[model samples]
Target: MIITVPIELPQEIIEEIVQLTKQRIKEEQSHQTKVNEIPPYPTRKQLKQILKIGDSRLNNWIMNGLKTIPFGKETRFDREDVKQFLNDLKI
Candidate 1:
């Protein structure tokens, strides 16, 4: 003897799943924006002090794209950027 069962998902459940998917996508976008937001600037000395890393190391990070340090032609470090970098380092 073989038993066969028909399985069907309710329309309400499908709608709920679609709504949840959209909500999750929106939340992910918001999170990405927060991550992409640029931090403020810090001086070279201040950055070193805060991150406890040498100038070369920080420069390497910038070069490798692990972090972003925007600067004008004069090349200055943003304090808030360093703070954010430090925060990112936290496990």
Candidate 2:
């Protein structure tokens, strides 16, 4: 024996629900990918290397808008923030 349930929903509403679910699943997958891939704070030198910028340029970026987390003598930057900064610079 098989049981079936029938429900009626507007086509637009169904489409919207499907889209939202897809977006949510994508976000969950993206978060999982980054959850264990990055460190909380990356050192300034490491950031410079990641961005492939010289010291002077890095200083210029820091002055422009890049943010840093200071821990006594060590300065670190959030990897996500750095990526966002670079993304924001795209024309």
Candidate 3:
């Protein structure tokens, strides 16, 4: 056996809940858009251009443990791996 009851929430509370849900969905969509924009493997020139890092800085980062992936005739960087490597460097 089960019992059921119906309750009503204050209108302001309901509106707040709806607004928060919309905000959360908007944030998720924005994040997805940004994530989708990045290629899984970006070439050296593309990476440098996007990140605005010069050759010596890129070399220093690689020396400090940044990694590269070979893509056919050129070298590329894994987007996720690069993100993790840089995040790990944060103080």
| TM-score ranking of the models | 3, 2, 1
> What lDDT does each candidate get?
0.59, 0.72, 0.76
Q: Model 1, 51-82: lDDT tens per residue?
A: 45797997886775454444665455654554
Question: Residue by residue across 1-91, what tens digits does model 3's lDDT show?
Answer: 2322246877777677777778998986775565445578988887777666898988898899889887799988898977777678778
What is the lDDT, from 0 to 100, of the residue 31 in candidate 2?
Answer: 55
Better of 1 and 2 by TM-score: 2
Taking the tens digit of each residue's C-alpha lDDT, what string does model 2 give over 1-91?
Answer: 2322267877787777777778998986775465335466888777665455788987887898989888889988887777777667778
RMSD of each: 12.2, 9.6, 8.4
TM-score of each: 0.38, 0.54, 0.57
- Best by the lDDT measure: 3
Winner by TM-score between candidate 3 and candidate 2: 3
Candidate 3 yields a Cα-based lDDT of 0.76
Stretches of candidate 3 off by over 4 Å are: 1-37
Clashes within 3 Å, all models in order: 7, 0, 0
Give the Å error, residue 61, model 1. Answer: 17
Model 1 off-target regions past 4 Å? 1-7, 40-91
